[model samples]
Target: MADDEGLSNEVNLQQRHRKERKELQAQVQKLKHSIPKGDKRKKKEITEQIVKLEAELDQKQEKELEELESTTNEPSKVAEQLESLTTVDSDDVDVAHKVKENKPSRAQKRRDKKAQEEKEREKRIQEETINNLMGSRNVESETIKAILDKKGLQLFEIASDGNCLYNAICHQLQQQGTEASNDSLRKQTADYMRAHQDDFLPFLTKDNGDIYTSEDFEKYCVELEKRPVWGGQLEVKALSHVLHKSVEIVQAEGSSLIIGEEGKHCDSPLCIVYHRHAYGLGEHYNSVQPKSEETVDEFT
Candidate 1:
């Protein structure tokens, strides 16, 4: 066995099975003999023992037979011992019972659901704010891009404090600007970021995400006034246009006579084009109503 790598190990298993069979047979015979022909107590003990031994014997026989038919060299002496773990007889499961026992109680479930809903509502608001910022016309692309590229604790720092880029740019254009100061400028930037958290954070993600200009940020702030709706589904751009006085309109969806002049796309093509400038004349950020659907007139 030490020298041969591919040895057929069968005799060992056969011997083990034979030994077990003999032991069980001996035990069964002893129990059968021990029971006094008319003694009730001794007969009960013998009967219980006989039942146990018979079950064991049946199990051993099945295992030994399976081993004899094996081809993959699995050990036959320790054949798999399988047993029914549960005594459940029915097919239908009592969901309500399981829910009562395994799941959260009614009050706990309500609390959990409330927490989840609140979280989702906050998230939706954040999403809408970001979209409004992206769509706003007040801010510039380069300014937003530079802010987003800034990394590390600097983001938090700026958010808490603010940036002086706008001020610096203004000063430079006036020809009264000096070199950008490290400490002072960073502090200013941090202050600005902190002041405009809702505007900036919504558009910012370290990875590929929305980034908006100062105008967009302001627009979002305006929308915060008389904000409509249950949650924030509308993006910051739409919010800024309506809530904040930002972005101009090139064309708008004028009313049509078709279908009783319903709305845009009712009896016309999408002719609405808001101006791409800050301070749009009459942009309103009201709740976006669900579009009305139409039905075909059927006749026999």
Candidate 2:
């Protein structure tokens, strides 16, 4: 009787485990399709979660199979015990069977329902967040593209590394018959900022809202020159003066910003798009280029 009960428990446990595994597999599928393409960071996070769940499933399955096998091996002993226990009361047998079934009581069922609801709510929230992020990027990209279309220009995508701003500027310069390396641009911008500290120092503030000291400014310049730090409006203004060209920042909304327009060093400006939410990591920039014949035809 004990052997039979042990086998039954093992079978029930395996069934529960299978159900859990199936649910996990469904979650993995949902996650795989939840986000848009080009979101490498989010995809990586989901992949890690899927790997963890699969590992857990494999471990549980192995242990359950071993337990089930051990319980199944004593069939002959179970048969003898069953024959001897035939004289037991039918009502007692029914009660024993009910106990072995291990059905959840009302309290457990309520708790389980509440937990499942909470899990579902969390999943919904995750899906919504990803959708919102992707939607915002799509809208912003489209808006910027519309503006570029008026000028016969389109977005030239740049890598999302910290050097996107410098890379974009280099791409524009190269298109204009000026080949400048990103490293050189960074150094030039830093040097320009260092030389004109008064022009930039007033705009910079510490964490406590105090003006940056000379030492703080030096460290900032070093970070720009040696590190892959992201460049912002300050760096853009410095680059405009360094490159002797007005830098125009196009955006999805509001009027475009033209830096160093007073310099009037060139007939045309170096155009770049500024994205606030296009990339999940943070702000990004892409070069604006004139459309080629093939691209123009496709757009038409």
Candidate 3:
């Protein structure tokens, strides 16, 4: 019953958000058409309304999706009871046979369709997250693409399903003849952060400038170890320290920052490029591959 309710709620929320967004868009267009172009105050008011509506819609969609995803693993309570009843050793053979009857063919089809929809929904959510995070920085995709080309580097794309950063780092390591996995990296990072709290605590402040307490920091480390949180600068620093490797991030509009303990412990550097709005308005991570000097040695 819970899962059914979750699916129903997800569908309703999606429809509501889409309808509301269209209504807001229509209102904005109507206001624009009615107002004189010279009326700066009226134009500003309309612009503000549009921004507010967009933000509200975005928040609603994100929250609904989160709630839907949380309940996805829960089977309906009725199904569990029915499943338990199937195990009974009843004397009535005919009733047992009926219980053993195959499910309707359409049921399987419905399940398949639901699974596909869930996959697509998750993909859309991830794309939205990337877009929102990168959009805040005013990063441009074309600028980053040009910069990579100028640097003679190619991008090896990673899946943008919340593990792009870890996958990108793994790809970079693999290119250098090393093997790594996302889980291992997450564990190592969390361990490093927990072991050296003082080193990172001074910089862990909320948006309002309140410093994170030790307990809060520990909870964050636990989440990092267990949750699929998108890796950021903090993770980069932690991973660098744990692996004793220098990680270089090439950004579109900012100077590259090197993270790690720079000393004899550092070996070859791993390079990853960050793109803004290049992959469907989302921020993404990709391994930076440079051209080899001895290409065409075999004389094709």
Model 3: per-residue Cα lDDT over 1-300, one tens digit each = 665786788788779878987897888788778765334456667778777877687667666666666566355754675576676766554576576565433335545776798799999999998986677444565566677788887656665556678878887787789888988888898999999899888888878999999998998888888876767888888888777789988887788778874745877888887776556526667676775432221100
lDDT of each: 0.38, 0.82, 0.73
Give the alpha carbon lDDT tens digit for every residue of 5-111 in model 2.
87688778868988998898899999999855545657878899888988787667666666566656567876775677699998987887688569764345655
TM-scores for all candidates: the values are 0.20, 0.63, 0.49
Worst 10-residue stretch by lDDT in candidate 3? 291-300
How far out, in Å, is residue 147 in model 2?
Answer: 3.0
Residues 176-236 of candidate 1: C-alpha lDDT, one tens digit per residue: 2234342333334344444756745565433455575566655544433323211121232
Instruction: Please list the Cα RMSD from the true structure of every candidate, rounded to 1 decimal place.
Output: 30.5, 8.2, 23.3
Ten residues in a row with the worst lDDT in model 1? 152-161
Best by lDDT: 2
| RMSD value for candidate 1 | 30.5
Better of 1 and 2 by TM-score: 2
